[model samples]
Target: MFWSKKNGNKSQEFQEILKLRSELSFKGIQFDKALFQLLTPLFEENPLLFKDWKDLQNKVLQAVEEKTWTIQDEIEFIESYVNLWKIAKSDELHTQLTIKGNQQDIQIFPLITFGAIQNALQLGYNSMREHPLKIRIQLSQSTLQLEVSNRVNHYLQNQADNMQFEYWKNRLEYRYPEKHQLFVNSNSNIFKSTLILQIA
Candidate 1:
């Protein structure tokens, strides 16, 4: 809703959104049954809940019902994930997403970026008092590159160094074998991770 109001949607892009929205609405988790019956009435009072429901379908629940993921979906998922926390702690954030290359052509795993983003928010001060959080993405050829940087507390520095992010490593290896690389590193005031995924 806010996206359309803020940026006038081109005819093609608008139609694409409407079409995907329609498919996702009708394709999975029938509202006629148990889960729907439990949550229907609350939707009217809590608008954000409704929004989360849709995002949950696209960003999470769809793993069972769908096999395809567009770059736009990934971008929106990242934005939505951050915005929830940002809304609650707006003053504590100095974060931004810097995207490059062609978003439309890249195919990515939904929620693949979640682990890195979560760690950034947790390990970093993420406020005016510290250096800003950097969420950067770039696509070149058949590979996708992601890097997240944060300013963290000195006492918690050990925790940052110990993070293995094995979930991501295992998944990426299973999907792309040696084609992908994932790792995390930190120095005194900054902690960061870099992931290069081949997602052709």
Candidate 2:
């Protein structure tokens, strides 16, 4: 009877041990996962991301020789580009893309949002599943808008960033000078940028 009782107690302790491991809790404080845990997800994701990366690169290369894009073309490029980031991050980063208007037969500057998105991902506040990085595109009869927002990462705040706003500024000035507006600011630990161009 004593032997059986001791065996049952050992089984209970083993179960508790497993519970503790799965919960990853100690003294009621949860532990952050080890960095190594990211490797599995990264490896699993790169194969698909490689294909996406190639496609994006090709698009960019083609654009260098022929710089022409319609609103719908840019829309498709952003969708694919953002999807690359989504897959590469493997849910380590959260992303949302919302488009609320139909395509129009209007020309738009291609790759306008790429730099902004790169900045958002690189300067992510947490780059964790709980945080959100959003890219929004809103098209109306008169205006086309692209906006990106993310929590500011304090750690990278001190580092120099080359967003090349000048390049975009020149492009916008040349294309839509008086017809476009550019807004960028990092206030209260939130970084946001929006470009609105008059298409009509």
Candidate 3:
């Protein structure tokens, strides 16, 4: 009985070590992937522009070694990743942005919240001139809200774009614990997604 219990504990410990290693490996792969995805356009357009390619390579290695990101850290990480991609694409493409409405002091996972909304703005809207997408951030007494609204085509009957939004919603639950709420709605010619984070 003593040997069985000791072995069980050892097995549990070994499993935990494997789990941690697996998570680290997955994050390392994702970091590399996100960087490649961001930098590929730059390399394709002007290889010389990536003059500091070695610096980027070092950063990825460091990030992996540190196991650097928490659930909350992923927001800023993705935001920075996407922002670089946008800047790289700007040489040939013009991406316009309009920021309106009020900004608030959101205490919980600010980077993630900002990144989700930023990425959503790019992906959620079909066109800037015709069906413009609007994202607004506001704060109440104890709650912070991110509202994303976009005009859609009348012929499209389903909320096909919501699957992407749903991924962020799940991330919030995992990252924010019990402090976040997400509301999503679609109507004729419009789709709206709202994320509410309660101040802790």
The lDDT for every candidate, in the order shown, is 0.63, 0.61, 0.51
Off by over 4 Å in 3: 1-39, 47-106, 114-123, 153-164
CA shift at 171, candidate 1, in angstroms?
A: 2.2
- Name the regions of candidate 2 deviating beyond 4 angstroms: 1-48, 64-66, 158-163
Q: For model 2, what is the C-alpha lDDT against the true structure? A: 0.61
Candidate 1: misplaced stretches above 4 Å? 1-59, 64-68, 160-164
Best by lDDT: 1
For model 3, residues 50-112, the per-residue Cα lDDT tens digits are: 654544444434543223243224334443444454455454322333333333333454243
Better of 2 and 3 by lDDT: 2
Q: How high is each candidate's TM-score?
A: 0.66, 0.66, 0.49
What is the TM-score (0 to 1) of candidate 3? 0.49
Ranking by TM-score: 2, 1, 3
- RMSD for each model, in Å, please? 15.7, 23.6, 8.1
Worst 10 residues of 3 by lDDT: 92-101
